[model samples]
Target: MTAQLANVAAVHADEPSMPGIVPATLARIKVELLGFIRNPQSLVFTVSLPLLLMLIFGSVFSGPVEGTDVDFRQVFISGIIAAGAMSTAFSGLTISVVIEREHGIIRRMASSPMPKSAYFIGKVLMVLITTVLEVALLLLVAVLLFQLDLPATAALWGTFIWVLLLGTAACTMAGFAYCALIPNAKSAAAVTTPPFMILQFISGVFYPFHMLPGWMQTIASVFPLAPMTRGFRHVFLPDTFKAVEAGGVWNLQGIVVTLVAWIILGTFLTAITFKWRGPRVR
Candidate 1:
């Protein structure tokens, strides 16, 4: 008994200390990024599809918005950028988590020595990085092809960064929570895509917010995408274009509040619902 105890103590002394949360998260981020790079089809769907939509819509609606000097293409570009971010964060994350759970990868990871929070942090960070890339690509195209204007002031630029981060975080957390509803990988798209599509349409991505029916506009206001779209527009569109916004003003406070609320709710839901194993697992 004494020899066995001594041997166990020696083995414990030889084992390296586990990394801190930040380091573990960063390492996990690297792994997630490498996995994403290897999956070219994810890039095609997550990035390419949005770019295609931007080109089609931007070209189709090249004229100025009705009653405002702001170009419709500019509005479309900002709206699509917001929608694309949500797509990468919410839809993409949900599908990925569902598939991982279904494949037993999540279960294996849960049993691993790595910090459990690292897995979720890595997933959300991966989505944020992809979202940034998507937004940059979309903005580059908008600037080159549609002549969309960049944010004029440092303050506007600051707004852009915060809005992007907060919106992405809210969507990421929501994705984690929503994935619990998915029964398996096969139904991921069926469960996630329709609501995303509907949000885009109602949240002023496909049409101007002011133009949507009052009921639809009110419904869209309850979701993160509408406020996110409006926030993006505040950065890109001219002040005069505020006339076209839901309240005829740039309600920055409302946008921030809505996003923060969603983030809180999503975090709570994720804590309760998230499971390492698939729903069918015993």
Candidate 2:
């Protein structure tokens, strides 16, 4: 008994002391951010693509939206902001996580002394930071180059903040849950990109929500991106524009409820489906 106790004590002494959650998460955040910065493709897709789309669409659609006084550019900017957030939170996370899993990084991390909760928290927080930066850059360009108007009231700004936070959280969790669909790193983009691209088109990122076909609008309504786009439009566009949205109203309560529902669903799915090992591993 005494010998066993000494062995256990030695084992515990050899093990690294676990850091507090904050410090551990912060360390993971730093690592993730550095990896993101080093990967030029991530920067281009997550940040540059949205900016390019904004400039092109903003320039091409110069006139006022049909049946409304608001510029089409303004509406497009709002949708694109949501698109940017989705790209960073959803598409980026899915692809990166799949790649890491396939490379055995996730497996190694699982066996390490690091707290899994801290690691995931770091990932989510990193995504939130990147999403915020991407959205801010988009807004800056929208305001400086496209002359997009800022929210006129504090209430509108409040709406923007909550919508941004909730929407991002939903997308991040959804991305984490979606890793189960990807079979390997090779198919990550193939599995993830189609849904993301389709959502952008049908969810009003590339066009006006009210002008989409009835079927498309119905599909978009069920997903998170459409509601996020509508929420953003509420912040930047005139209140009168809400008359043109589905059901002829802004539906602020509905937006919150939809995003919150997605957050819950995504979290549940992630809890059940996420695997530390690669898909093919025994």
Whose lDDT is greatest here?
2
lDDT of 1 at 171: 92
lDDT of each: 0.90, 0.91
Clashes of 2: 0
| Window of ten residues with lowest summed lDDT in model 1 | 58-67
lDDT of 1 by residue, 7-63 (tens): 999999888666788998999899889988888988789888889999999877777
Q: Candidate 1, residue 11: CA error in Å?
A: 5.5
TM-score of each: 0.94, 0.95
- Mark the regions of model 1 whose C-alpha exceeds 4 Å error after superposition: 1-8, 11-17, 280-282
* Tens-digit lDDT track of model 2 for 101-157: 988888887777788888789899999999989988888999899888999999999
> Which residue pairs does candidate 1 place in steric collision?
none
Task: Please give the lDDT score at residue 194 for candidate 2.
Answer: 96
In model 1, the Cα lDDT at residue 52 comes to 97
Per model, state how many residue pairs clash.
Answer: 0, 0
Query: After superposing candidate 2, which stretches have Cα over 4 Å from the reference?
Result: 1-8, 280-282
